[model samples]
Target: MRFGYFLSCEEYSPAELIEQAVAAEKAGFDGIWISDHFHPWNDEQGESPFVWGMIGALSQACSLPVTTAVTCPTTRVHPAIVAQAAATAAVQLQGKFVLGVGTGEALNEHVLGDAWPSEDIRLEMLEEAVELMRRLWSGEVVTVRGEHYDLDTARIYTLPDEPVPVYVSAFGPKALEVAARIGDGFINTSDDADTVREFKEKSGGKPCQGGVKVAWADSKDEGIDHAHRLWANSGLPGELSQVLPSPKHFEQAAQLVTRESTAESIVAGNDLDAHVEQMRSYVDAGYDEVYVANMGPHYLAMIEAYGRDVLPQLRG
Candidate 1:
């Protein structure tokens, strides 16, 4: 299985993100996965750089393949615009970019004042958005009047010779089925073997990608504190993440998530065995690729530790 670093655009500045990319490649990561969001999930997380701009920088600064851990093309931006952006990124990366997309979260999409649609409607919109993007990527002028989006003779002027592969992110059975039917690959956050098995079964064996969050620090307590302070929102159950409307609301909801909960959700510590076990769960789950986002300040150290003590074991 291939391994990658998950660049949390919500948590780091643009320059810091670039530095991490360079460090990740040097540390033997196979690629990088970047989260694309207009706003951080909680104010404590502190930043959300425009992913396209950061991606352009990464293209020049590093040689690793890049994928949006998942971008929402269904709402915050028009699929046509996302098509153009993905096309440019693919060319910029010399065909090494994957456009990972999802139906979207209310935190990002609700800012435009568009009422967040139910999950069913969001899935429908996502399907149509992917179709429109594929059509545009084919270098054909596309005009569509679909239920959720419309295109008016839109043609992408610049594209890689091979179309950028679209990886659809799913957390539910319905969305997983949709991903299977329409996507070039699949992306999910769960490391559960059942979940990964189900995705592969439904997707007819397309590449399955998983992402996890950890807090790597000199001590377990320090790691726990970092995770509790920054990622407590992650412990909110199920659909809460998708439906929470803003960072403030998320922070409010996260108040219910205890420090212990944060530690449970985020594997935090310096124990090499603990770190390896967290990743091994994904590898054992049948994920073709697993990307990790180190949640604390010791990012470079985490990368070094992974390179020296983690990835070699994984590869072996």
Candidate 2:
């Protein structure tokens, strides 16, 4: 399976992220996935760099392809804008960029103060949004009036050698179906084989990528503490995924996930078997590729260990 790094675009400056991208490429990572958030999921995690600008800069500095962990075109930003931005990035990258998108998070979408739509509405909006983007990319005068959007004399003429691939980031059945039917590929991070299986069955034979975060340290306790401090909320079983109105709301929900919770959420320790088991779950579930995120201050060590200590054994 292919491996890549997942960057939060928080807790790191643009220069730092670009450096990380370079490091990841040097480490033989296949791709890079960057998060798109107006704010960190929580205040504890400060900094959310402008997503497009960062991607553009990284494209110039890194050899590996980059994808937005997930951008939503339906509400927070118009799909047409996303298409145009992606088109520009595609040309700049010489075709090393793919637009990874999702229905969206309240953390980002609530900025407009529009009532958060239900899952069905969000899915419906996604369909219309992607359709709009695809239409706009043709460089044709697309005068489309849909339930969610209306475009007139819309066209994108500066497309690169080809259309940028669109990958859907999905979490459930209905969203999974949408990803399968429309997306060029699928992106997820459930670490649950069953979730991937359900997604693939609907994803129309599209390629799939999953991101798994691992904290590597000389001691397991240190690793666990690091994971807890940074990503404990990921353990909330869909915390703020639907309920939070904004990053502020997410911050509130995340406060519940303490170090004890982190121990439960993540696969702790340097146990080769545990890591392998985590990786196996994704592979067995039909993920075409897996991106592993090394979460900790000692990211360099994590990468070294993966290469020098973990890879040979996994391959063997």
Candidate 3:
């Protein structure tokens, strides 16, 4: 399995993100995955730069292939606009871009003041959006009058030689079905063997990508502290993440997430063995590629250490 770095737009400034990308390339990461968010998960995480602009900057900064770990093109942004932006990014990256999309969460999408739809409705919108974006990428003028969206005489002028691959992010059966039908690939955040196997089986062997978050600091305690403070929401149960409407709501819910839970859930500190084990779970689970994100201030050290110790062992 290939290993890549995940740049968290929700956590880092644009300059820090670009620096990390460059460092990741130097550290021998295979590619890059970037989060697309309008708001940080909570105020503590502290930044959310426009992902499209960052993609453009990354294209100019490094040769690493980049995938938006997931973007929601169905709501805050129109699929037509996503199509144009993705096409331009692919061209800038010389066709090394993958548009990873999803049904989206209220945290980011509700900003436009639109009512958050149910999961089924959101899935339908995603299906329609994906279809419309694909049509737009063909470089032909297109018109559509669909249930969720409409297009009139719209055509993408700046196109990549090949259509941008749309990887669908799914966490459940219904979403998986839509992913198999529409996605060029599959994306998920956990090291879930059953889900990965099911997606591949249903999709006829398309690539499956997964992502994990870790905190690296001087000691396990320090790492746990960072993870708890910044990403405790990651431990929330059910659809709470999908339904929480703002950073404040997320913060309110995350208060229920204790440091012990964060410690148990997140790989922490400079224990190379622990880090390797977490990543290997994704590999063993049948992911084609896995992206890793650092959750604290020691990101530079984390990347360098991965290059020096963790990556070599994994490759071996």
Candidate 4:
């Protein structure tokens, strides 16, 4: 299985993220997954730079393939614009980029003052968006009058030799069906084996990607504190994350999230055995790639540790 580092745009400065991308490549990571967000999940995480600009920096700094963990082409950005941006990124990355698309969360899309559509409507929009983007990527002059989007003679000139692969993100059965119908690959954050299997079954055995967040520190307790402080929003119940309108709302919901909840959700501490075991869960689940995000301040150390210890054992 391929191993990647998840660059949390919400947690790091643009320069720091770029540096980490370079470091991650040197430290034996196979690829990079960067979060595409307009706002951080919580105010404390505090940084969300334009992901496209950073992707350009990454292209210059490292050779590792990059993917937006998931971008919502249906809402905040029009599918036509996303097609253009993705086509440019693929060319810049020398065809080493994947456009990971999803139905999207309100936290980012709601900022445009558009009403948050229901799941059914979002799914419909996502299907149409993917279809439209693919058409544009093919160097076709797309003129569409769809239910959710409208386009007029859109064309992408700066495209790679081949169209960029699009991986759709899904957590539920309905979403998985959408991914199966349109995606070149499938992506999810959970390590649930059954869910992965279900996705594979639906997608006709397309490539599957998984992402996990971990906190590595001198002690497990320290890691737990860090995870709780910076990533508590991750543990919030389902649907809440998708519907929450603002980072402030996310922070409010996160108030009830405890340190123990973080410990359960996130792998923590410097124990090589534990970290390896956490990653093994994804590998055993038939994930083609598993991306790990270091949830604390000391990402450099985490990169070195994974390079020195975790990655080597995983190879064996």
Evaluated with TM-score, which candidate comes out highest? 3
Candidate 2 similarity to native, TM-score = 0.92
TM-score to true structure, per model: 0.98, 0.92, 0.99, 0.99
lDDT of 1 by residue, 148-255 (tens): 888788899998999899999988889888998898898988888887787778878889889998899989999999999988988899899999999999999999
In angstroms, give how far residue 310 of model 1 lies from its true place.
0.6
Best by lDDT: 3
- Cα displacement (angstroms), candidate 2, residue 107, comes to 0.7
Which sequence of candidate numbers ranks them by lDDT, best first? 3, 4, 1, 2
- Give the poorly placed runs of model 2, Cα more than 4 Å off: 268-273
- Please give the distance, in angstroms, between residue 206's alpha carbon in candidate 2 and its true position after superposition: 1.5
lDDT of 2 at 97: 85
lDDT of 3 by residue, 1-316 (tens): 7999999999999999999999999999999999999999999999999999999999999999999989999999999999999999999999999999998899999998999999999999999999999999988899888998989999999999999999999979999999999999999999989999999999999999999999999999999999999999999999999999999999999989889988989899999999999999999999999999999899999999999999999999
How many residue pairs clash in all the candidates, one count each? 0, 1, 0, 0
Which of 2 and 4 is the better model by TM-score? 4
lDDT of 2 by residue, 144-190 (tens): 88999988888888898787899998877778888988899988987
Lowest lDDT block of 10, candidate 3? 255-264
Please estimate how well model 3 matches the true structure, expressed as its whole-model Cα lDDT. 0.96
lDDT of 2 at 313: 58
User: Model 4 over residues 132-206: C-alpha lDDT tens digits?
Assistant: 999998998888888989988778899899988999998788998889889999999988899888878887899
List clashing residue pairs in candidate 4.
none
lDDT of all predictions: 0.92, 0.79, 0.96, 0.92
